[model samples]
Target: MPTLVKRLLAALVIFLLLVVINQYMSKEGLFGFGVPSYYARLIVLAGINIILAVSLNLITGFTGQFSIGHAGFMAVGAYSSAYLTVYYAQAWERSLGGIVGGSLAHALIFLLAILVGAIVAALAGLIVGIPSLRLRGDYLAIVTLGFAEIIRIVILNIDSVGGATGFTVPGYANFLWVYAFAIITIVIVYNIVHSDAGRALVSIREDELAAEAMGINTTRYKVLAFVISSALAGMAGVLAGHYLSFLSTNDFQFIRSFEIIIMIVLGGMGSLTGAILGAIIITFLPELLRTLGPRLESLLSSIFGADNIPASVHTFLLQLANYRLVIFAALLILIMLTRPQGILGTREFGLSWLKRARRRPEGDKPVGTGGVSIAEQEPPSAIDRAKEVKNQ
Candidate 1:
């Protein structure tokens, strides 16, 4: 088949799939198969987290960098995007409203804003990755963390972007936009990891010195991974900022960075599937706890009789919901102790599993007499030759 034909077919298939996904996810459905509004929001948030986690995985998992300031790049994306949408969305509404209408005009406007954010974030990645090339392990971690703090502080002091008061973003981003970028992020990261560059990245992770000794440009590849990861994190930040319709420096604080790191760690550092799984679990866990806490408190109150319970106890019950981080931390500790490799542990689930099943394991070859490899021995040409060999 011609390459052009193959490319066209692939493009067509992707377009169709995107259309189908958009329809199914929309409030109105083709076959009455629309998702509920509440679940839809969760899915969107999960998609954003997935992008964040997967990008982080490329740097930390595949490239063997232990960065903890990912949230800083996200902050760069979020604030820049938010600023554009909030401050400049009216330009779109005023100029393009007649052509694209209010909604789509705003979306296009914000999409451009998001691109700016992503670029800024990628540049920030270069800023951090380049200066700290000689640093490794905790030293690099500290540098990244410092960079994130610097970003947050800079945002906090920027009077035009709401300063410490924070900025309100237009609600231009939705599930469709979020999921679209998420899928793009996954595809890009997956392709990078599966390519020759990915091997070099992984080799750097395995042993930087050895990879360098083999003539691999370790610093360049590491920086490339950093920039890509940072850009994707920025994209995630853009989605979040637009979705929430607000932005605060506090929102992109160090803890947010840690949460992203935790997601990658919990999901399995090097596995895309693991990143996704970790993202889902991490994103939903707080909601679950917050929801469950009240129900459990009500059950306890009802069972024990409300009159018998002290006001202090009631207050404590309410506060229990806020301890989700503590609960999450405990769970993380348990996971580390039991399955240190994470849920997937650098493994993925796909057609590759089927391929593995079909091939015999390298260690499974049969050993003949005197430890000879049966695989290496050829059979007799004829039955008479076999008989003569047996007689000998």
Candidate 2:
């Protein structure tokens, strides 16, 4: 099939999926099938985290670079976007007047603000990537980590945007908006990974020295990957700011970056599917654990008889919420010990899945030399044919 045709088909499929997803998000339910609002919010967060993971995977997995400042880029995006929508929105709204108004105007403003923020964050990435690209290994990681701290400090001191008090952003993003951006990020990253440029990136990852010797511009590609990755992280931040309706430098702390890293690493670096799966798990795992305490308390009560349960034991069970991180960390450790390459490694779940499907005609059967029905026969293969010839 033509590339354009295939792309159109993919776009159509994506549009349909988004429609269904949006329908399911409606409060009254879509044809009696809908997720609760809280769960819907969780789903939106998963999509945002997925973007962060896939974007980081581009740099760390495909390009063989280590960056621990994803949250910094995210902060830049959120703050810039919030500053525009929250503070300067009326000015833009007035300027638009009859050109567009109401919800339409809001949507346009939201997208424009996000774009501006993404550009600003991309510029930041360029600044950091250029100076830091010369270094490698721990040196590079240190530089990126330091960059994150600097961003946090700078944002913290900006009193106009609330300083340490944080800023309240306008919540203009719905699940559909989140899903749209998520799809855009996925499509863009997937194409980059599969394109000629993507091949150059993989080459750099495999052996930078070899790729450089083969006439590839290693520094340029490294910086390109870094900037793109950072920009995507910024997009995620924009979505987050709009969805959560608030922003704080603390929210984009180094630990947040670490969580994104954990998602990609645990899902399997270099695999898009892994990054997505990892994002979903990391986002929902805490929510799942919140209920674990209550469930455990009830189960233990039933098992040992409620009257016999000690107050100390019950208190300890109630305190399980504080230990969720410990449990989450243990899960990561166990996963690492079992599958060091990550959940899916570098494998993909793309078109090859469809190519591998089989459709045999009904009532199809094999016949022996005597023209009698053969209930079972060896599957067709070159090796099987050779074995039959050898037997004859």
Q: Pick the candidate with the highest lDDT.
A: 2
Give the per-residue lDDT digits (tens) of candidate 1, residues 108-213.
Answer: 7877888999999999999899988568999999989999999999899999899999888777777768877887888899999999999999999999999999
Model 2: per-residue lDDT, tens digit, 1-392? 99999999988898888878888886877989899999998998998998899999999989999999999999998888888887898678777866876667777888898898789889999999999987888899999999998998999999877789989888888778888888888889999999999999999999989999999999999999999998998988999998898888889889998999999899999999999999999999988887788898899888998888889988988999899889988988999999999999998766775676676655653456444455454456999789999999
lDDT, residue 380, model 2: 63
Per-candidate RMSD, Å: 5.3, 6.6
TM-score each candidate: 0.81, 0.85
CA lDDT of every candidate: 0.87, 0.89
Best by TM-score: 2
Off by over 4 Å in 2: 1-6, 26-28, 31-33, 94-97, 298-313, 354-392
